[model samples]
Target: MFDKLKEKLGGFKKVLGGAIEEKEQEAIKAGHVKPEVSIKKEAPESAKPSETVKAPEKAGIFDKLKAAVLEQEFIIEEKSVKDHLWELEMALLESDVALPVAEKIVEAVKAELVGTRRKIGSDTGNIVETALRQAILKVISVDSFDFDGFVKKSNKPVSIVFVGVNGTGKTTTIAKMAERFKEQGYSVVIAAGDTFRAGAIEQIERHADALGIKLIKHQEGADPAAVVYDAIQFAKAKHKDIVLADTAGRMHTNINLMDQLKKVCRVNDPDLIIFVDEAVAGNDAVERAKLFNSAVAFNGSILTKQDADAKGGAAISIAYTTGKPVLFLGVGQSYKDLIKFDPNWLLDRLFE
Candidate 1:
């Protein structure tokens, strides 16, 4: 899912490498540029036999060259670390990491590097690697979620309801989830309860059509609760293995919509209330999560746009603040973009 982003970043890295090399060359030239100098010494005028004197040994060209190279190497090494750390910090900021969160990350990385001794062997690389990993883990560790505990094995079908703010990819996520369930050999059905947006029903319909799954939708501006009720009834009648209900994305501040969402929950009583959020939403994403939790009490989260330049703070902060597991991450816009959330994999990407 992140293939495009990876490729783009690879090209950028190449450009940065060239720039750093040019800077290093310029530094070397400046360092070795010799300055003309005249030395003045006072000598006694007394009539005394001049003693044989020796000229100070001149440093060889090779020695001068070697010293210059070593100096450049040392400068490059220090700059490389600082540059890499700065890149990490910038990437996090671009991904919507809050100012405070970004600051904490930088401080953690600095603390790990300060007063730390590098080993005299290949293990030196390991020490730096370990420190980077630990700092990233510390920031993201608060929101780690496990999917293993929530996997259902019962004969009864599992019900998952998708909720989120408008434009957070709620409907599309449901489509993706349906495709996933179908691939697992489950008879999946969708409840298109997002009756607010025009063409919302059609969007879900197109996905259901593509996946060859059944969908239940009411007329435009229909009561979402009634639609969910009907979908649940159909799932029970058809013995569906799973029912995924898509709800209208509403602002958390809307008490009327929040009440309506509560009504939907009451009617369907879904086994899993999954909140769909865009990964790029940043800190505002955390606030959305908290508001949704107050309204629907979501059981888990499905983060979309993970492949985008998101600082990934939303994923961590939301999970930590709401105390909900992250079930899936949408890494791309494709059907297979939906991936089960793996904390270890996420940690590796963030730190490594």
Candidate 2:
């Protein structure tokens, strides 16, 4: 998924390895530790000593020198890693990482590497990768939310509203969530609350029909808030375990549409508000998430089109921007392609 970022991090690893190696060599040249071979060259035949040196004594000296060299420890100073940090910063920015997020990752890497003690000849690449992984993890794990745990414990017919700008896969994500909940043994009801756009109701109805789940929808130009309210009432009567509402996609700057969204929430009082966006949208996705959170305040986010994302910046930036966890990732076209977001899973994919 994050092919570009993976390549960039690999480059950073090489740079880090070289920097550490150079620092180790500089320490050795400065006589900070004993050399591995300190024994004097065997005397030329013409200048040999009359008495032969003891083999055991010479072997002991060689072992001591080797031990001294292997046991030496070097501290990773910030100066040595400065270039690496700069390169990392540029790489992150180019990958569409938000400014603050890029800065946070850089600072984290510095905190993890600077002044750290490592024995001479340790695996430098492994060390760099570990530090980078932890830094990225810190950036994305700002808030961790367990989707299944919340759904299991929440009251019956837990209502969730999906909000985001247009063309960010909001409808598809709603269908995916409905399938997920159904597979988990919960009866799901879908609300086609996106009444503004033509075919919005038909789009959701097709998914509901395919999934054999009930859908509550209104005709075009109908009040979206009314649709959601009706869906909640239907769920209560039908004993449905969850209600997933799909709202019309609207820009945060659209005062009228945003006001309609507020009305929907105020009237229906959903259990959770999930912002949907595309991972491939990069910095734009991050900005939209921030704006949406400021206006309506979503609980979590679902990032779609991850399978097509080469940079994978939105996943990292959205969590930090919204102070909310990424509940799910839409990986492909199939309903089953929606996978729950896990920090470790992302780290493994990026680093491995």
Candidate 3:
């Protein structure tokens, strides 16, 4: 899903790993640190070098003690590390990460590089990889909720509203959500609240037919809020456990439409409002999410078309910028392609 992003980040990883290895080797050649094979073998007092061969700086007892203290320190040149980190920053930018996000990534890598304590002869590559993995996880999945568990614990007929712009496959994401909930043994009803778009009802209807789930709808150009309210009432009567509402796709700048969305929120009172977007859209998706969130204060989000996403910046940007965890990813066209979002799972895929 993030092939291009992974490719770019892989180069950054090599830069960091290589820089650390280079510094360690320089320390080795300068006799500041021992080789790995000799690390566990301490120099015996009986085997101490003759005075004539002793280093001038360690001739005095206090100097020897100072050298001993310095030997425990692992120093990485900040200037040199910054050079490598600059390359990393550019790589992240080229991967379509937001400028702020890319900067934050570089800062994270730099923070891990400087002032770090490493065993005298440990593998620098492993340390670099571990530090980078941790930084990325911190950026993406800072605070998370278990989607399935949260929904399962919610009250009966819990409403989940989907919001996004046109052509982001928002409706399809809702269908996938419905399919997911149904598989989890929660009876679900889809509310076709996207009354403004032509053929929206038909689209949801087809999915409902295929999934054997019920669809609640109003006429074309009808009140979306009314459709959702009706759906909730129907769910109560049928004892359905969940209501997945599909709202009309509108640009974030459309004041009237955004107002209508607020009215829907007021009337339907969705438990979770998921902001959907295409991962391939890069910062545009991120901006859209921010705008939608400002209008409705979204509970969380769902990213779509992730299987085709290459730059993969939207996933990181949306999470960090919104301070909300991505609940799921639409990896493919099939209903089963919806995958739960996990920060560590994504890190494994990104750095594996």
Best by lDDT: 2
Please tell me which predicted candidate would have the highest TM-score against the true structure: 3
Query: How close to the true structure is residue 155 of candidate 3, measured as C-alpha lDDT?
Result: 88
TM-score of 1: 0.68
lDDT of 2 by residue, 283-346 (tens): 9999989988888889999999999998988987889888999989999988999989998999
lDDT of 1 by residue, 1-352 (tens): 3333233334333434343334334433455311122211222244133221111234432111111112112112333345555765666556556666666766676677544322211133344445555665665556544443444565456777888899988887888888887777789889899998899999999999988999999998999989988888898898888888888989999898889899999888888888988888868887888889988898888889978833567765666567776778988877888989866677656444
Q: Tell me the whole-model lDDT of each prediction, alpha carbons only.
A: 0.66, 0.83, 0.79
lDDT score, candidate 1, position 298: 85
| lDDT against true structure, model 3 | 0.79
Instruction: Tell me the tens digit of each residue's lDDT in model 3 across 38-89.
Output: 3323343353223111223423222211112124235454654666677778
RMSD of 3: 6.5
Residue-pair clashes per prediction, in order, are: 2, 0, 0
Ordered from best to worst lDDT, the candidate numbers read 2, 3, 1
